[model samples]
Target: MTDSQDHFDVLIVGAGMSGIDAAYHLSRTLPDMRFAMLDSKDSFGGTWHTHRFPGIRSDSDLYTFGFEWKPWTGVPIATADEILRYLDEALDENDLRRHIRFGQTVRAARWNSGTNLWTVTVERGVETVTLTCRFLWMCSGYYRHTQGYQPDWPGMGDFTGQIVHPQHWPQDLDHTGKRVVVIGSGATAATLIPAMAETAAHVTMLQRSPTYYYPRPKRDELATTLQALDIPQDWVHEIMRRKFLQDGKTMVRRSREEPQAVAAELIGAAQAYLGPDYDVATHFTPSYRPWRQRVAMVPDGDLFVAIRSGQASVVTDTIKRITATGIELDSGQVLEADIIVTATGLTLSALGDVAFQVDGAPVDLTQSWTHRGVMLTGLPNLAMVFGYLRTSWTMRADLVSDYVCRLLAHMQDRGAASVTPALRDTDRDMPVRPWIDPENFNAGYILRALDVMPRQGDRQPWLMTQDYFDDRITLPAANLEDGTLVYR
Candidate 1:
């Protein structure tokens, strides 16, 4: 690979699903435009490559997670390795290998408004290099290479037991014969508890607040049975995909309309499955609406059964402080533990903490509102691609990539210098809150970029249209010169 510094019409940071999708689209649609994709790691799959926690699998099915052009061939909910392979194959098929600069971490990007270009600084190995580009599309997914969010508990320093964070799971850390207490009831915690129960002496999931958990069928037996009855694999996938969308959307809508009813019904189902002794209200009832935060999907209520069988337990209490022996609750109860897994939550950042500048002035992302959650407001010749949390993130990301292609073509045809979002009065335009886990700002990643991110409005696109069928018409085919977008 040539190490000589080069210039490109567009520069993309992070070669994750979003970056890869953007690069592929840019390469195909704007073949004449020079472009480069960078990754801090030496691999293409960003999160998939980095996150190797036990039983880690995508929350969404693959039909939505995969690219429109590239269909998913593996299991519906793919493993990390399978997802990585699919990403690699996508890059290979699209001939994007040469365009990606791996092991290069972007330090800062300054936009020169006068020159109408961005000067990007990247650290590769021991040397720092600079790249100039006409446009910068930040595809760096939320978290940077910084360590995961680990809270400074009161007695963390005194605890002699092995503490593990899902982010940096030590390969040598042994869980055998250990009584583990996994903190946080998010997806990671749900995944960890059952897996650890199989080997550990006991596993307890401690949560300050209750979470909504749904039992999702793992194999889609009906779809499989249909396939055996002579249904084509593609047909099976499409049927199952539609069914999932219908059911998911219905639950989300009903949950918002009648929170208490939905909560009660869910609790009833859980109690029926787990049998009475478990405190379903305290451990399963969330204070927020059903879809306020993402609901963890447990396959076949496996988590509930794990707790029912005495292999695992769920404790609903505020951690008053951390003790050397165990986590102390506000009620003064301390459950001893041999291991602690702080599956607490993650901290999210915009552009993966990569700096941005418009002309000479530094871009204060907080001052700007997101333009359909894809591009920053008032930024010209730039766009970002982030996936959805409710549905498959990749589905929205892939559509955004295609839209960027169409947008690039529109700009080229009209000889436009730049495109930016036209800010409107807050009263007229509704606010949008991103559909992410609502952990404390300091405790997780979402804190850094929350102010900058648009708040979800009560309306359609302004509110994250978690549905793909709606976004297809709105994003890919929608008029580019809509009043919200301005071309320079």
Candidate 2:
């Protein structure tokens, strides 16, 4: 990559799904606008490209997870390789690869009101390059790609075998016929247990507490039925997307309104897979309500099948420490292992932890309020793609892409150089809250990063409502003439 300073109408940070969607929208909607996409990694597919654990797959169904514009003909649940292939195809079909500047990390962005441009400093290897853009799009995502979150347990150095975090998986790792102990109950752990059980001597999934596992078929019945009828791929995609969205909205609403009923259905499903003999209450039932944390999807009940086959087992107990041989349980049980896989959650950063300045003053993101969970209050000409937690992530990405394009077109028509979200007289006394409400959803990763993320105001435009059903209707219908978004 060259070190020369360049200017663009829009600068998109990150070449992942969000960035690619934004770029695609920009290309389609504003064909004459100059734009560039950057990713710290050498290639696209942010999480898909980076996470290389065994049987790494989408926790959410691909119909909702896949981009709305692109038709996904693959199974509902897809592997990382499959997703990468899909993403790669999207890039190639749209001629998007040429617009991406890989291996460049956005270091800092300074917004100057005088010039109405963002002077972005990016680094590639040892060379620092400067670029400016009229509008900055933060599609970098929230997850820290550099490392996964691994808790520091005592005697970790004493362990004789390889201890790997799923995020930074070793390419040459061979766990065949080896005793593996995976320390997690989330999606990664669920995916790995069955995958490793195929070759490993045995795999034990150790969790401090249980997470709800929702077993679903790999293929969507509707999609398969439509394909059998020889319906067009685009029509099938839209039909499935709408069906899933409506179903998901109803489920989420029910999860909120009838927590116990939703929880019972999930537990009953697990019991059906594990059989009546298995301790479903101890290992399958979550203490919290459904959707409090993302329910891990087990395609075809693979994990339960592995457990039922006696090739794999689940141990719900607190870890005391790591010994030379295996993990020591607080219950005085010692499980030996040849390999320990930390299927721990992600290390997140709000807006990729990049330094931002507004006309020279450093922006304090934690102090600012999120505007529709897409743009930030007091941040001019900037929007970050923070996707849905309960639903498939790509759904929110697609919506935000359309919203951004619409916003840009509105600004152009109004001859506006910059737009910022400012609190009006009506919003002066509005109460503030955390990025995510703990009562509604309290995942460990989100709780850990509360102080590092932006706050949310109590009202409509100021709140970062994670509801996709509401956002889909509200985002596009948002009035540009509204007093909240100040145009200059």
Candidate 3:
């Protein structure tokens, strides 16, 4: 046990994209504030460092995905190595590495009202350590890192060939000259199929349902043109950022208002890449509106190229059982494969699965409401960064970081030791809804964890719009004295 007097002013969990962003904001906004960061992983680049699967890359454009303070000079779509390098550069340039303690997994955080601080317990290797902080910032991402979601098939153990999950890909596994079957049509599956097809004898993507996919250029022509004109890097970054934000807004609106037309355009693009006679509708046309699930980006149409070249194929059928050689489909067909890659989906873990208690009482996240999409209701001096689904995650992450810094500044000015978003009497009467509407953002992982996640009310800070443009103006500029936020 350590004395509470030695605690940091702020303690940040997870040294990945969100944590690094928070640290950058803190450094710029409050250089005098004492803060430290802890990450379960041994290094930075959270997801980028963890998943070393083939063809791993960003599903969103780098201009939007990259930090607002930094200019991304690479191509629009970046590979895992490129992203890891970028993160390394960011940490070095900002000197954030000095404040990070690696291999520290936070297990529980208990808030003490008497001391106005949070006591966090973390496990580092074989030792247990406890620390305290005035504020707790959770940057740990939404999904579980130890394992991805793998459904129980009738006979998964019957498979004789090697089976792998993208989350835990074997470094020495060989795919060359082998038949591979990838299960799922999400981002991971979409990325793996094309990358594996180049070396595998034949690759098949077996999905129960189709997913919306958009072909994005590997390079950005507008950015290239601007740079060719000798435009400043900062100016180009801003221009591209705004352009992508507006384009994302328009795309989401169009997807909702004119789903059929948007669906046709997406399918038509696939036809262009796969040849005029290819049956794109059977494998690419999603039943739901675009953006309901993330629209997987196929960089430079690589997946379609592989499919057109006869190296890869798509089978839309449910698996009835797993055989020794491959999977048996409900349609009375079996796809034989030498290797099986289950890219099913991710399992959402709220706040890194850290158990939270306030004043010795357990905090049920499901009953709490979200405040401005950053903090949970009734949680004092805490903020969690959960990014937008429609746009690049960093867009919201950067904004949330800026907002949290502003909040801390306000608290300091008021000499307040604690601040919590509490529901007002007026808000209590409002309808409580799921944090997000499943119909609007029905990604499988989100739907799976909806029951355990936080809720949202109908009005103001209690509701999360998931719109960057709307949040950009409201979150940073809103009055801190709003009735919902209680400062003490």
State the lDDT of candidate 1 residue by residue for 250-330, as single tens digits. Answer: 887787788788878777878877898767877887777776677777777778889999999988888877778888899
TM-score for each predicted model, relative to the true structure: 0.89, 0.98, 0.98
lDDT of 3 by residue, 1-488 (tens): 65744489999998888999999999999999989989999998889988999999999888899999989888888999999899899999998989999999999999999999899999999999899999999999888999799998998899999989899999999999999999998888889989999899999999999988889788888988998999889899889988887888888999999988988898888889999888877898888888889998998889989999999999999999999999999999999999999998899998899999999999999989999888897689999989888899888899999999999999999999999999888888988799789977989889999998899887788888898888989997888998888988
What shift in Å separates residue 397 of candidate 2 from its native position after superposition?
Answer: 1.2
Error of 3 at 275 (Å): 1.3
Better of 1 and 3 by lDDT: 3
**Candidate rank order under TM-score:** 3, 2, 1
RMSD (Cα, Å) of candidate 2? 1.6
Q: In model 1, where do residues sit more than 4 Å from their true spots?
A: 1-5, 229-236, 424-449, 452-469
Poorest stretch of ten by lDDT in candidate 1: 435-444
lDDT of 2 by residue, 1-488 (tens): 32334889999999988999999999999999989998999889999999998999998878899998899998989999999999999999999999999999998999999989898899988999899899999999888999789999999999999999999999999999999999999999999999999999999999999998889888878888999999999999899888888888888889989989999999999999989999998998888989999988999999999999999999999899999989999999999999999998999898997999998899999989888888998789999999999988888898899999999999999899999988889998988799999988899999989989999988888888898888989988988778989999
RMSD in Å for model 1: 3.5
Cα error of candidate 3 at position 265, Å: 0.4
